[model samples]
Structures are given as C-alpha cells and as structure tokens.
Target: MQEPPLRELRCDVAVIGAGTAGMAAYRAAREAGARAVLIEAGPGGSTCARVGCMPSKLLITAAKAAHDARRAGEFGVATGPIRVDGVATLQRVRRERDRFVAGVLSEFEKFPNEDRVNGRARFVARDILVLEDRDTRIAFGAAVIAAGSSPAVPELLAGLGDRVLTTDTLFEIPDLPRSLAVIGGGPVGIEIAQAMARLGVAVTLLDGGHALAGLRDPDLVARANALFAAEMTLHFGTKVERAESAGDGIRLTWAGKDGAGGSGVFDRVLAAAGRPPSLRGLGLEEAGLSLDEKGGPCFDPRTLMGEGAPIFVAGDAAASRPVLHEAARQGRIAGRNAAALVRSGPTGIATPAPWVNLAMVFTDPGTAAVGETYDPERAAERVVGAVDFSRQGRARIMDRAAGALRIYADRAGCLTGAEMLCPEAEHLGHLLAMAIQDGQTAQDLRDRPFYHPTVEEGLVTALTRIIDGLDAR
Candidate 1:
C-alpha cells in the first residue's frame, strides 16, 4: 500500500490551520473515515494555548485572587496588605500557557496520519493546493479552511509598535503597565481593563457605546456601566482621535459623547478590538471559492461547504460567532460533513440551526448574555423575568452582590435568553445557556430543583417571575 514520494499528496480531506477548530476538524475527520493532511506554516498548537482563552483566564485568575484579598474586609475577614508580584504572576501565566501548548503539540505529534504539510498553502485549482515554497501539490477531495484569525488593529492605529498592545501580544510583555488605556471597550477590553486595574494599574476604558461590554439590554447596560464606572475612568460613546508616543509613554486623544475631547498619557494602550478572518495569501479564488460581503469564504452555514466547491469553511477563518466554543462546534460539524462529501454524500444538514449565543465578559461583576439580546422592536412581545442579585441572600452572605439579571422568554414560555450584570455571572450564564440550548421552557426551568442558599436560588427566583408572566399572558 506504499505510494511513490514524488506524486500528488492526495487525501480524502485537507484541513488548513492547527488552532482549536483545525485540530477538532482533523480529529473528527479521522473518525469519519478519512485521512487528512493538516497544513500549517507556523507552530501548530492550539491558539487558545498560545495566546487566547487559557492564558487570559490564568492572568484573570491571579488578578481575582489579588482583588478578592483586598476586599476581604467587607466580610469581617481581615487580611494583610496585598502585593501582587507582576513578574511572578506573568511567569506563572506563561509557564501554564506553555504547558497547555506543549500538551497540544504532543498530541499532534502522535496523530496516526503524520500527514502534516509545513509551508504556505495556496489554491492553484478548484481542488488543488500547492505548497509554494516546498513545491508540493495536494489534491484533496474535500478541503476545510479552519485557518485562524488575528487581533485586528485599525489602520489608523498602526505603527505604534511596542507602545500599543493586543491580546495576542499582551501576555508576552514581561511586566505590567503602570497605567493603561483600553481601546474598543468590549468583552476582551473590559476583562483586561478590570483585571489590570484590580492588580493596581490605573485604567481608562474608551468605548464606542454608552454600554459596558456592549450590553444590548438598556437596563443591564446602565447597571454594568455604573459598576465599571466606579472602578475605571470611562469615556463612553468616544473614539480615539490620536495615539502618539509621548516620551516613554503613549498619548491618546479621544472625542467624547458631548463632542468634547479628552487626552491621556499612559504607560501602554491595549487594543482588544476584534478579529479579522485570516484570508491573506490563501488564493481562495484559485480554488473557485468566492468571498462573502464579510470577506470570508462564501459557504453554506450548515455544512460549511463552499458554493458548489469542495471547500468547507470553519472556525475563525469563517469569522462566524468568533468564540472558542462556536469554533469547536464548526470544526466538528465541518469535519464530519467534509468527510461525508469526500465519500460523495451530503451531511444531511441543509439549513444551519443556530446555537444558543453565549457571550461572557470576565470582570469583577461579570457581564454575560445568552441567545437573544434585547431589541426594542421585539420588546413588547417578549416576557421579561428579572432578579436583582443585590437583594439575594447568598449575595448578601458573600457581600459581593451588586448587579441584576433579566431573562427573556417567548409567548410560548420557552426560555429564549438572558442578560445579566451579576456576581458569578460566568456560572449563571452557562446554566441559562444550557437551558436555552436544551429548549427548556419557563416551567421546565422552574421544575429543575434548586438548592437553598446559592446563586442557583437566584436563578429560580427569576424563573418564577417568568412563569408568572407566562401565566398572565
């Protein structure tokens, strides 16, 4: 069964990139009765291991400890002065991050196929990929673009070099900044802003909207904004007018909501803006793959298949949802479907069913939303269920409650979504998200047993309210 070395490296599937989605796709494709060639030009470890989820969470975990120690007094638990070792903390983050990455790399090395192609990949024909530098050609029956994305910095903010930081490079810095100004006050920005501020960095968050972390629910937005306003200097409805080097620091000028301008000289300016789909040098047109208005591969959302082509788009490369979990789902589904296509079959999925949208911002009083965000147009038809954590017994016991939760439901009583600015919202968010994903109704959610004296109790209270609203209608 051995083949000649000097021929087309053809396979049932060819997967691009080696990030979270790419790896998942590769594994799933293997299980789906296909051999795959995973192509990457750089280290093929999970992106989350290197620069994303895991590392950021590690940094936040350290910040949370330092933060919690400082606020221990509210619970009559007196603690000594807290001093965070920024150098040591960063060392731990990198060490753990590297360990996670190493594990992924090791797993990759053990992959049975060992059909990895190292070098730039470009489409020379509809189903033909050429490794330009290596002069290797691969004709895959089905190809997947799990190519990952990178943090997007505006062209206007380019050339700042070391003065500006992105999430991808933020953890690389050896030391924390004395002062920081965060651009694009979204989830990533707010998380880093608050975590650093808690770790003792003076922080200023300049966001596009009046809301903190883009809360669509007006009431939740106001509450979350008020919470963050007390900690960091906030300039909402503002845009960065100028960013320039000022001596050893960076000077930023922003135009505020009132048309008034504000300026600050900071030790660093971090951009947690957004991720652009990685499409550079891909030569997708050579594969007969067309691009959508979003500048991504035009693919069927359900099967991730390119329009009448053998290419399936997955993960950040497609820029759909842009969350790790969503990317994972895309990769698995796309991997299975791509293999099926290679077998001359359809995936049996026509229209893509939307997953429950779950977004979380890790801050002191975390911000989270699942599924539907509040829209004024549909506000009247939806039933609202709410609970203020500030009044919850468990929250009062912990002395850390300072936010609210609002759950929305359809007229048929199915739990649609929730927006919350609450303590331990990350946990609360997952629970609500799972409920929505499982198609649980208000009564069904209420039927779930609740233990006394816990955050789950708070959710129960909210569910009861929704049930009442359902009964009234």
Candidate 2:
C-alpha cells in the first residue's frame, strides 16, 4: 500500500520535540497503537545526544583519565608530562555524538506508525500545527509539547560575541582556553569547571547564590566543595558587575561577600547560568494557552493538558523543572494518557501520575537523589541518617573517599529519600529511586543481599547504619 501525500498527512498523535522526552513519547504512542509524528527544530540532532550530555561526558571521561594518570605515581608507576589535545578530543567527541544520534534516528525510523518531520512546529489551532519549511499543516487527535530548553544568555554580555559562549556553543570552540571562567555553579557549570580544571585549564567557577542550592544536604555540599577547592577557584555569593573586552581575552569585574570586589582576565567565559524552556514561536497564546507566573504554559498536572482541550504539554515546554530523565518520564505518561483520553474517553486510563524520584547526575564524583531531603523546619520531622563514603571499603579501594550517602524515612520506617555521591552514583540512584517510589523502608534494602566487594556494598553499609541508628533511638 502507498502512503498518502504529505499535504494530506495526519496523525493520531503529534509530538512537537524530538529530544529525549519527545522520542520517548513518540515511541510510547506507537506502542499504544497510535499513528505518531515527531517534529524537531534542531539540526537533525538532540542536545543530550549531541552537545549537551554526551559531549560533556566525553570531556569528563578524558579529564578523569588524565587525573588518574597523574595519580599513577602512587602505584609506583612513573609517567612523563601529561598532554591533552583539546581540538582533537573535541573532534572525536563530535564524531561519537554523530554516530550515537545516527543510531537513534535509525531506530526511530523502524517504527511503522511513526514519522519524523524536520522543522519547527507552531500551533495553528487546538488540533492543527503548521510546519515551518513547506505550507504543510498537520492535524491530530492529540498533541504533545516536548520542546526542550536552550541556554539563557544575558543581554548585557552579548557584546562579547564569540568570546562568551553558552553550553551549546562552548563545545564548538576551536581551542581550549588557558584560563576559563564559568559564570554559574549549577550542575552544568560546576561539571564543566571541574572537567576543564582536570584538563589543565585554569578554571574559575562563579555563582550568584550559594552553589548547588538544589542540594539541601550540607555534608554533600561540603564534600563537593572540597574536591572543587583542590581543582579550581570558586567564587560564591557573588555577582558579575561587568565584562570588558581585553586584548586576547576578557576582563570580568565581580563583587563578592560583603562588598568585596575583584577582577580577573580569562581566555574564555562560559555562561552556564541556566536554561529557559523554548516556548517562543509555538503560538501558545494563539491556541488559548496562558503562561504561568514563571512564563511557561499553564497546565493541569492531573491531565497534562493546556488551557484548551486536546492540547497537552510535556517535557521542558510544560511548566516543570527541566531535566532529561524527568522530561522523558512525564512524556511517556502524558503520551499514554493523551492517547487513552482521545481513544476511549477521559476515564479510559487513570490520570497521568505526578513526577517523583527525579534524579540528577553530575559527572565528577557523581550524585543522585530521590524524593525529598529532610529539613527540620521545611520537612515534617522525620528520621534521617547519612554515612560518608570514606567509611565504605569499596570507596577506599577506589581511592574515592570523598563521597556521602544519605537516607530519609518517616516514623513508620518507610523510605522517603536517598542520596549518594560516589562512583556509579547514577546507577545506584535508580535503585534508591525504586525504594522511595515503592515505599520500601531502609531496613528492606539493608536486609537484601548484595554482591560483595562492589560499589553496591556501600548501599548495604549505609542502610545498615540507618538500621543501627534507628535501633539505638
């Protein structure tokens, strides 16, 4: 059978972004027997699979290797000067990213019910979308907004031009900076700072607020700070007064704690301050959707629906904190729930579940958390226990003693949250997420047999400490 022409094309579900969340939703919709289509504004690639997560992790891997080589002297192995070919390394990173994205695109092409449209999509009506390239309009029974975010660039520093780069553009620079100043201490900023410092860049990390504010645990912050202090210069609770063009670099003036001022010259400056969801050009308002106070689409969390019927929001486009994993999870639920509502009615399937077990991964020493941290005043009084990775034998063997594991539980012993800082923290994060999501107690994990002499043993030890402390209490 021959497919209909592009002009007459329509789908059961239309997803407006082809990033992680959009791809997940497209796949889910196909699995649920809906004809699905994905639209991407990016240049046939995704931020995560391209310049965002994948390239950043590649840089981190090279940095880690260099760091380990420098420490090889501890094992009585003599080494000469360490060299990093930044340009060549970046080329290799791009090649790897291209290959990965190609593989993903190939797999997506295998879906019989799914189609990929390469262009920007804007809402033409409640059920209609207009593609940018041709005069093509698509109508669908349901639509998902998964458009992800782009780096936020301050207008004041726009004059720096190529000298100042956002996360998306920084990786494309031809040469590595001899001295780099990162203007934000969030995950992207700190991760890039440490990775560059390890690669022999004189790196400085500046944050307007206390660094890592999302991390509520002071001990985890202290441990991360110690590692960063050894690797790079850190300026916290500071604001950039101005940035001026210099001979070959740029000069930055900043004010620090209690009106203290300082100046620095840097070869390059990366603005990793944050990202705002890509909401423009979507004609959201034209479709009757109103922006929330934070300037995102107002959504009903229960239905993932926008102001009007049949239009749903998901991923970064929705009024939710942006994270790749969370976006994908929400996209799956939203896609499924959207299909159910359109197919069998609102009661066909339960409402999309609220997000939980959101995990964040920072490459250096890594970190992962689920549920909520225990704050005496902020959180209902609960039982909390934290154990240092220095006490874990596996961490000792790995020579990574700078880590922490924490668990939070209620009076009934049901686990509420777990956080870990160690090698494979991302992997361990999922395990902890399961415990929190399933309402399992710390004792339940402690009693479960784990493989001996592995990183997982740290979890067992941490859980045991929680059990012992509870017994003593």
Candidate 3:
C-alpha cells in the first residue's frame, strides 16, 4: 500500500505550547495580521492557573490569615485559641483555582477555531511541524516555542513514587501534611514551606546550595535565613544521599550542614528544587535547533530568535525569564517579531528596556529584587542604602517588621535596584522600578511624597541614605 500524502497547511508562524506565553503569542500574531496556529500539549489554563501562581497564592493567603488570627493577642484583640480546617482551606484553594483556570480557558476559547490545534507538535523539517497524533503537517513561515517547564527532580529523588511531590501536585492534597520535607531553596520551595508551616505543618526546608531563594547576597540571604528559620528548620549545603518508601511516607537521607549526616521520614516530600525546560520529544534537532547547556533551544535572550533558524523561543522554554509577566512580555515581543519576519521580511527583534527586569517571592515579610543584583563581588562599585525595619514605625505597629530594605545605586545617586524582606516588599520594588525605568535618581525618589507611617516610608529612609552617601563621597 502506498503511504498517504502528508496533510499540509501554511501559516505565518506555528506557536507550540499554549501556556501563558503561547496564548499571548497566538493573540499577538493574529492581531499583527499574521496567520498563526497554536498547538498545546494539553488543555489551556496552563500551569499558573491550574497549579502554580494562583492556587499556591490562594493557600498562602489562607495560611497568612490563619497565622495572623493566632497572633491577635499581640494587638490586644484578646481572641481566644484559633483553629484552621486544613481540608476546608484546601477546598477554598481549589474553588478559587478552578475559577482562575476557567478564566484562562475562556480567553483561549475566543481564538479562531482554525488557529487552535490540540495535539503534540514536533518538527519534522526546518519549518515544518507534524501533529504527532493525527499526522497533520503545518509548514509555516516561522515558529514560536513556549513549551514551559517541569520541576527538576534530583536523580536520587526520582523513583520515590507518589510520596514525592512538586508544585504541580502540592495542592492536590485535601489536608496539609503532618510533617513535610521541602527539598529546595528557590522561591517555590521557600514560599510553600512557609505556607505549609503557617498552616500548621512541621516543615523542614533543605537546600543543596548555600544561599536561600537563589540569593547570593550574603546580607540578604542571612536575613532570609533568620526570618524563615524561625518558622521551619532550614539546612543548607546538604546533598541528598537516598530515598525509599517508609510506611505510607518517604524517608529521605542527606548530608546535613557542615558535612554532618542526617535523615528524616516525612509525611510528604516536596521537590521544589528547580524548573528545567520541558523540551523532551519535541524533535528539536529535526528543526535545525541546537540545545544549550541548560537543555533549552539556543536562542538570543533579547530577540528570542534561534541561531540561524526562523524560530522564536519564549517563556520558560527560552529559559531567559521564567516569571509569568516576563513570559507574556516575551511572547508578545517574539510574536510581533515573528510576524514581521514572515510578513515583511527579517528586520531583527527588539528587547525590553534596560534595567527593567525584576523578581518577587511571596512569603511572610516577602522579598523582592529589581534590576541586576544578587552579587556581592561587585559591591565596591555599588552603594547600598539599607534600612532595618526592626525599628520601622509601621512594622512595629503591625508586629511583622523584621527584615532589611537594601537599595542600590551608582555613585551618581541613580536608583539601579533594591532588595528587601519587608511587608509589601513587592510593591516597594515595583515603585522603585518605575524610578529606575524613568532614569530617576535616588534624590528624585526621595523628593516624591510618601504617606506617613506607611511601609514605603522605610523606602524613603533608604533613598535618603543613598543620597547622603553620594553627598559624602
């Protein structure tokens, strides 16, 4: 029997993986008047809604309320003993998560039917993608890959069965664990550790690396340890040795701090270790793409363009900026560029404005970092205006102020970046980002009026210190 002819169609760009970045790219490409088709590995809503940012944050908010209610005595509210129904809390989280997931699905529903392709896509040619399930071939002018990422489970922890969890499955539980071993020091690990702990779980946070939250700033890392340690036992510089099933749980063995050895059996083990790009089975080599050391398609971080290929890689797959906002921004940027590359010829690509990149961790006394930082090696060239919130007015009133606000600038007093573990730290970093984006100096931020006794007042104090140091120098 002769092989059936391959089904073929043409489009401006074939967008693979319908996550945050992929959806954004699909819409942007269409609005740019380019015919683009989007292929998703699964249903729409993506990780953020289904499991990550939204659901996790809902649980965090519940945990925060529970913790705060227990501490009502500090404010002389005279509330009696408090209690939390963990199952009910989880149900609420699921309820809200379903709503968020539905919202994202609704956005995808508005897409043109011809543009949405549901199947696994792999490149069979330089510019050709074949839907693995139905043998539908799409020959496109260009392509955008935003396939997203998966939790990086360490080799030792891989075969531990259902007891091992990631952010992807952490919320599936009806009740919080009695004891949890969180195996990472990244944002997900730290945030979830604190959340579970506050919700009445005994959490032991372990990190293979020395720094927490991937922060290398010695001072900030120290502050995070001091704060987060109060809630859970945190071990750094630890290497996992083994794992095995233990009475409906998992027993984890590791070399503890200072090369000491220890082991523990936990009700649950969460591997918030890292998020490596999910590029398996994509047949990237067939698409004429080279894989980098990080297992991502080697693409220009700024342009999102594959080296010498008519492809733009965005979102977690690009491994440039994994945050949702950054992913969406990358999607739009790559989408517009891909459309122009196919519709009007190659005109290159544009990157985001300088010094606009930022990151945030939503924990109690949350932390945020804006601009280029987390380095102490180049501290000499930078001035740090640090304000300890231990004595800050609003923090004292709220009984939640126990971190530092460190703002950085050059000798010229320009606001380059800021890192802080404080109340509403996310908002402070964003406000400072505006100044940095607008080319405002530290003095410029200081001149802006701040309401009295607000957490932002601490920012003013730090900004004043920066301006003062500039004058002294």
- Please name the candidate that would achieve the greatest lDDT relative to the true structure: 3
| Global lDDT of model 2 | 0.78
Clashes of each: 0, 0, 0
Alpha-carbon deviation at 233 in model 1, angstroms: 1.0
**lDDT (10s digit) by residue, model 2, range 1-473:** 97545564688888888877788888777788888888878764566776687888888888898899998887788898889888887787777877877876776566553387777898878788887764678888888888888888777678887889887887788868899999988878888888899988999888887745255577777777777788889888899989999998989999987788788999999998887888888887766777778657877876677766577787767646567777777788778866776788767645745656566766568888778864658445567666777777777777776678888877666778876667778877888888777778988877777987878887776677667767776
lDDT of each: 0.85, 0.78, 0.86
Tens-digit lDDT track of model 3 for 396-468: 8889878888889988888788877888888998998888889898888899999997989998889888888
Give per-residue CA lDDT, model 1, range 345-392, as digits (tens).
Answer: 664434458689998888778888899978789988888899998899
Residue clash pairs of candidate 3: none
The candidate 2 region of ten consecutive residues with least summed lDDT is 373-382
Better of 1 and 3 by lDDT: 3
CA RMSD, predictions in order:
3.0, 3.6, 1.6
Candidate 3 all-Cα RMSD? 1.6
